[model samples]
Target: MSAPMPPPTTLEHARWERFKSKLGGWSLTTYGILAFAFLYLPIVILVIFSFNDSRSVSKWSGFTWAWYGKMFQDGQIMLSIWNSLFLAIVSTIIATVLGTLAALGLERYRFRGKTAVDSMFYLPVIIPDIAMAIMLLIFFNMSGIGFTPWKVNFFGARLAVPYSVIIGHVAFNTSFVAIVVRARLAQMDRTLEEAASDLYANAWQTFRRVTLPMLMPGIIGGALLAFTLSLDDFVITFFTSGAGFNTLPVRVFGMIKKGVTPKINAVSTLMLVVSLSLVVVSILISMRSGSEDSVTIGM
Candidate 1:
């Protein structure tokens, strides 16, 4: 009979491999938990304090809805909220349109200085906020334009800093939206558009029917991103905003400078919820679109 073969190397390796893999997985899990805790702990405390009856953020006197009531009852807070919402909505629409066009032009067309153009679009995102703020302030000052609100007598109506904030938001938000839309466009298959064109479809028709549908996820995602950024922007808005114009973020900053209040916490909690909801919805929509595409391809 042949001598018993030495235990297979594979079997010997498997024994140690299982133990190492488990250890590695445990380490990764621990790290994830620690990271999540670090990021969310402050948010948790803020939310908890929003319901606290006490004026102090450090100590909770009792649970109450007084802060929430105060948040709404405070005329300044309500006005700031309205301003922020208006700015976000207007900026999101403008950014989505401009960024979508920019993405389409960049992705579908080739031209001189294309890379440079792309870099310029990304500059806002990469530059420091303070630098952007100062540059905008100086630009406004140099132009000899009053940073004050403009009154438009359209049909016997008046408008003010609402438009100014919206303009500022759109300027910064467009770059971010462009980056997001461009990323999505890059991942898309160019063949789809080619096929549509080969089927006797005009450029506009092909884009509207085939490309736009495919790009919807990106468009919506980018719009939501722009909205959130506009809502949360402080530094840029601070420099660009006219007198009597206050976005929610600027209002919050002002209040915090004075002192932290439960009303502020309530407002913060509400904003956190809104931001989180938008992000979650966008992610879900993207995931669903991806899943549908996968199924279509598989079939």
Candidate 2:
């Protein structure tokens, strides 16, 4: 038999492989650095300015904690912070429950116009925030409901505006939570449910004991996403919020527009720290969960 001919590695193939490897390596490093800078540069500046004694945003005076102390003393800021927290918590709860149920339904059941339904749920996410805000404004205006501008009842009782803002936040957030939970559901193993059913477990029992546990990570993740989005929301809240209803973001925007101050920087820095810490904690929890899952599988 003749000597086996070596398989040909064409010049084109070699060039393509070299290009891919080089491009992948360079792109990862370049993009990683860019992403870090994009996210953290503003945060770094904010933190630096927070310690500055000067009220001017650009000029740095001696370091001082006066602005932070002032922030604590400002009752409006404190009230806005509390309001934002309450809105986020309530909106996240509502969004998570509805979104998780929607995900489960979409993943486990077949129905008419399934693709259309998915697209509808995702439409809110893709719609421009300004447009959505405008639409919500129009809808609320046309609803024939009495728009009470503001009235201070006993104990400073407020009405309507804050709740409307929460409704808008929840409406947008539900779509996001649905998408995240749906993605998680798509990747889950149907065999587990099938096995549970084979073992004579009813549908509810299987879902409660087996499906729910597996879906918890995605549900929690979606809830966190909803909470963050609600906290960070500005446009919808601004449009829907009537007098006496100011969210943290809207308040900060107004403050910045009037004049930049170290107090604003301090608040921004605090928000950045909280957001980053939440992200890190979420990632750590996810990794720990994944590791535990792998160990269980191995066992």
Residue-level lDDT of model 1, residues 1-299, one tens digit each, is 46545547988768767877898999999999999999999999999999998898999799999999989888888777777776688789998999899988887799999999989888888899889888877777677564856444433323355444666678788887887777778888889899999999998999899999988877877888888888889998987785677878999999999998898999999899998787677668877877333221101
Write model 2 residue lDDT over 1-299, tens digit each, in one string. Answer: 47434437788677777887898999999999999999978878889999998787788778899999999999888767777777788789998898888888877789999999888888899999999998888777777542333332323534224556767888998888887777778878889989999999998999999999988877877887888888899899888876667778988998989888899998898788777776776676567657333211101
Backbone N/Cα/C clashes per model: 0, 0
| CA deviation > 4 Å runs, candidate 2 | 1-35, 144-161, 291-299
Best by TM-score: 1
Clash pairs, candidate 2, are none
Q: What overall lDDT, based on C-alpha atoms, would model 1 receive against the true structure?
A: 0.80
The local lDDT score (0 to 100) that residue 22 gets in candidate 2 is 100
Give Cα distance to truth, residue 137, candidate 2, Å.
1.2
**lDDT: which candidate is best?**
1
Q: Which segments of candidate 1 are over 4 A away from where they belong?
A: 1-21, 148-159, 291-299
CA lDDT of 60 in candidate 2? 76
